[model samples]
Target: MPKCYWLGWSGQFEYLERAKQRLALVVPLTLALIFLLLYLNFRRLTETLIVMLSLPFAMVGGIWLMWFMGFNLSVAVAVGFIALAGVAAETGVIMLIYLDHALEEARTAARESGRSLTRADLHSAIMVGAVERVRPKMMTVVAITAGLMPILWADGTGSEVMQRIAVPMIGGMVSSTLLTLIVIPAVYGSVKGWRMGRGPLREGAPERMAA
Candidate 1:
């Protein structure tokens, strides 16, 4: 017999039902909050949307990993999901910070040279920002994943308890790191392109600014 039977299966089901009901409220409200925050800081809807999309791709990997590990989807895992939301948000914020810094650097350079920052300059800045940001983020994720691996792989000493939390966290962190490093940059680039292609009438403004 399985040592740990699924606890509160009925209650779990009920909790899920309640969660489902609340999701309609939760999602829009959460999005509104994020939008409001982003608007207050950056005032750009397109950038916010791009950053948000990167989160789902990261979550896809996290979910697939948990399923492959034969872990039951439970309240603990739901907690992991909540943790992932914060992780994703943090990753987006870091990426945006790097991007903004890069843009600022490029603008300063352009001003010094008495030339407007071109599309190429902007692209270069974004690339540099992504590269610079990725190293530290990767190191952080690696350290976290490495620290948790033992717990996830432990054979005794109540390893099962640790696995429940550690597995999803490690998985989510890994996936979130990858998505933030790759997908977020791609999304940012695409948004930048779309903004640039809008022509000279709207040139020299950030895409997020346009939104």
Candidate 2:
């Protein structure tokens, strides 16, 4: 009769399991901290919510890239997502600030002209903000994506894991540009209007900013 012995997972596997267990708690704590920080920076729940919305928009691209690259969900992939979230939030912050600046400028101009903020002015301000920042935003996306491209193509030792990490970051950066430029502005415009309890273009116009 042959005796059979059971093989157990290696010590490294045990360690990873433990780390994965802790991650359940760690993830929520980190997300809460991110939300708190956004609230503190913006001082308005509406603005903070708009910035946080970008994180999910970023995930749309990251997940698509992961699927396209045939990477499974693993600790390394999760790490890539965490990194992507941070970058997405930062991009959101920049976009919001630019839009605010443009709106403020429009408000000032309208106040000086002794006229209400018309639809034309609102659209003009939105475009001013979006166009002025396009170069810098594209520069940021290109720089980060370019830096990660080599890793995505890496074939050396441990390249598989690296490529998994880089794929999402690249795709997320690409998609996040759209989120930051289009989605963020749209949401902020809506939120700003809601906060004023009126329509974005016609009611509660730029006159409020001057006061």
Writing each residue's lDDT as its tens digit, candidate 2 over 141-173 gives 999998999998779899988888888898899
Alpha-carbon TM-score of each model against the true structure: 0.75, 0.84
lDDT of 1 by residue, 36-101 (tens): 775565666676676666667767766877899998865556656656666676678778868777
Q: How much lDDT does candidate 2 score?
A: 0.79
What is the Cα-based lDDT of residue 121 in candidate 1? 80
* TM-score of model 1 vs. true structure: 0.75
Q: What is the clash tally of candidate 1? A: 0
Query: Highest TM-score among the candidates is held by which one?
Result: 2
